[model samples]
Target: MALWIEAESVERRSNATEDDLQAIIRAVYRQVLGNAHVLDSQRLTNVESQFRNGDITVRNFVRAVAQSDLYRSRCFETSSPYRFIELNFKHLLGRAPQDQAEIAEHVQIYHQYGYEAEINSYIDSDEYIRSFGEHLVPSARGNRTQSGIKNVSFNRSFTLMRGFAANDVGKSAKLISDIGGNLPTKIVAPSGASGVYSNTGKRFRVAVSQVSYGPRVTQSVTTFEVGYSQLSQKIQNIQKTGGKILRVTEVA
Candidate 1:
């Protein structure tokens, strides 16, 4: 399976030409918009003009694109909260959420601070600065090794990325069940076939850190082994009962 799409990094040069500026603009749209083709009507004319005139750096241009109404309409408004945040990590940070904490953090930011703040959290992050700096555009980094990232995130990134040919308009959060339950993401081939990634016949162990029984709150941890078909319902039940999920692992 091809885990990563190979693309040359497009960076801004000190003495940039007309062609250079165009390429940078295209790269910005391609990376920030999840490979979606930008229509002339959909283009952020003012932001593009600012970038063309060297008024804003690539980082700011990316910020502008992410926070644009077009992006909000396509990615945020139409997508579930989880799917929106997943795309943010893929498009801006060039990776998937490391764990549930990362996902919860972004979720909290979006709920408490608003959309622009959620986008800014990633663009202003140290990880973003270290990864792409100010001139280079953000792209999928699952192909390369990243410091402090877990091995499972590589598979999760591919799950979100799909490919360079694919756009970010997907509605469902692919890794939501796995990440929310702390399961390792399986890498499936992009052919959309049922194979190793299918959990049809698997069994999983769900660990809940806390669960409320009746009107009483119990802090004791509980574990439940369930089949794949029952996993979703079980997780839902856990959540409904005010349970904190610690992990969900496949049991052999």
Candidate 2:
């Protein structure tokens, strides 16, 4: 079982062969498109040609794919503002936003500068250069802890990843409420052979605060312990009851 799904890094070698170029093309689609199945018609042949002919660096090729209409329609137009920003971080930078400020900054940029600038901002970032360089493809760095990356980012990034087989067609932001409310995101391990679940049979405690409606309003706090499979539904139930989740901590 794999704990995380990583985009295979494909670098343009000085003496790269035709096979290498094809691999790079595949890698670009797999990474930038979030494992979405790309029909022949959906592929950027012109961009691939430029990459093959040594006309553009891998960075430029990544930028082109991200800017393409395919990416725009599937990811941007149909998604919420938060979802779009979230996908941009995952697809372009290979991670999740570190904090609310990062998400807010990108949202502000999109509101002011427009879509092209939003895409350009990630590609043109110093972090992008340092992490991926000009030739290497961007990959998920969520599973590994790195200096300067927040401890919470690992769980958040894994949330964005969902699972190895899951595509990025989901329209809602997975981390929006967590990031916006400054809440700690509980790491839910994915199911199946591709997903690693260390705490398979373990349980977690969900602390929630609920307000009762009546002539005299009263607030009550409660805690519920549930298995991994029941965690999501339990949270949904809490939200449906107009409850605010205060915290989710693993049971020892």
Candidate 3:
């Protein structure tokens, strides 16, 4: 007779704290804007004075800031906060908010929780606020800044354990028959061993070494090689082997 039992349980983790979200937002702003303090004091004062002198209005100041290097660097061209309030809301929520009311509500929530104060401090810092008023409007085209480029190429390799089988045959013929027939079966590596080269112009190759196998059997060295045309193929090879691909190591 045999007995068996089964059970299952589920657990949920806490969501990210508001502070964590705000920190990420601040980092993104910094990466885009560069150091805001670099803006010249004289330039900011001139812009401010222009507004006071009725040479340019407050709306012009906003427009000037919006088109300046500070804004272009901090704001994404398509999905930045300046383009849409919803995008800013999404940065905070980890997803886009549904409507203007939702955007306003979350912004308020962040403010109530003191997250906005931290955000305001970053925005008001010499690095951010001053950058806004430093430069004048260009005549024809928008200023472009360099971003999101990678230089080095790297490769990833992987191996998988497909499956295994074992047979034990004692001296007794009847015992062997009871277990299974003959034992000299072929052993195959787990399906799919794969590798990848991200960034063009680099080739990737995979070499598989048989780690260890057989009962009480020493003196074993097994090796094989397979090249992949695409990353998906590499993943497939590893999956077939029931083995994991190793981290990509760069080779130039």
Candidate 4:
């Protein structure tokens, strides 16, 4: 994060010297005090020490020192008395002030005061969530042939899905589409050899539809409707073949 302050002008005062600095300080003091002004030599000395220590520049220090209530009466007598002395310097000069390190330091100070909200607004613009799939049924066979059984249910299964921020929709969709075909598969039902069924001739085959992607919906969408339709069709076919659909007592 970065911060900055804009002073009106600077180049016109390029030749400013120590005398100019003293004049500005005196002006600030006079502005604060009126007819019975008393100069505080001790405080002035401390200000000079701060400047020598590089804690404050001559320009900034003079203004801050002048802002005391004593000086305010003389310098800024109006209701909208300008407390910012930097602006005054800019007005006296012609162009904006130049201080690279000062700007950087000011920016750092602003960040210290917790201005990260502004920083993040310019950086992150998306959010996302992860999803997992589950198995619905296990493989099994009936004693008598049925008309509508096609696929076997599995003991366990899983799938993956993504929920993306609105701004990330384009990229998210592309990525989902690219890896959609390679997603992990769940065994709805195991082969008869796995002891899922006793009859070797009663093995079931698994099939998956193309991965579907779309904006989130409040209720079920056309995709789910279509999937249900296909499942119903398969059930009908298995029932016609004399295979019975197994009914479970409870769902895990």
Distance (Å) between predicted and true CA of 17, model 4?
A: 2.4
Worst 10 residues of 3 by lDDT: 152-161
Alpha carbon lDDT of residue 35, candidate 4? 16
Candidate 3 per-residue lDDT over residues 1-252, each given as its tens digit: 111111111111134344543332233322223212334541345555564444663334534444454453444343312123322221221122222233345445545754334234333345322333222211100011212211100000010011111111111111111011111222223334422112223334433323344785443333223222243344334535644333322244
Candidate 2 residue runs with Cα over 4 Å from true position: 191-252
Q: In candidate 1, what are the lDDT values of residues 74-121, reduced to their tens digit?
A: 889988787798999988988889887898799899999999999999
What TM-score does each of the candidates earn? 0.82, 0.76, 0.20, 0.20
Q: Clashing residue pairs in candidate 2, if any?
A: none
Query: Candidates 2 and 4: which is better by TM-score?
Result: 2
For 1-252, candidate 2 gives per-residue lDDT tens digits of 565656566788999999988998898888889989999998999999999999999999999999999999989998877779899999999899977689879978999999999999999999899889999988898777876888899889988886557688656666654664457777765567655434436677888888988999999999888875566557657765778878777688
Query: For candidate 4, which ten residues in a row score worst on lDDT?
Result: 128-137
- lDDT by residue (166-248, candidate 4, tens digit) is 11101011111111222222323333443231111222222333323468423221121122113334433443444433320
Candidate 3: Cα lDDT at 4: 11
Residue 10 error, candidate 1, Å: 1.1
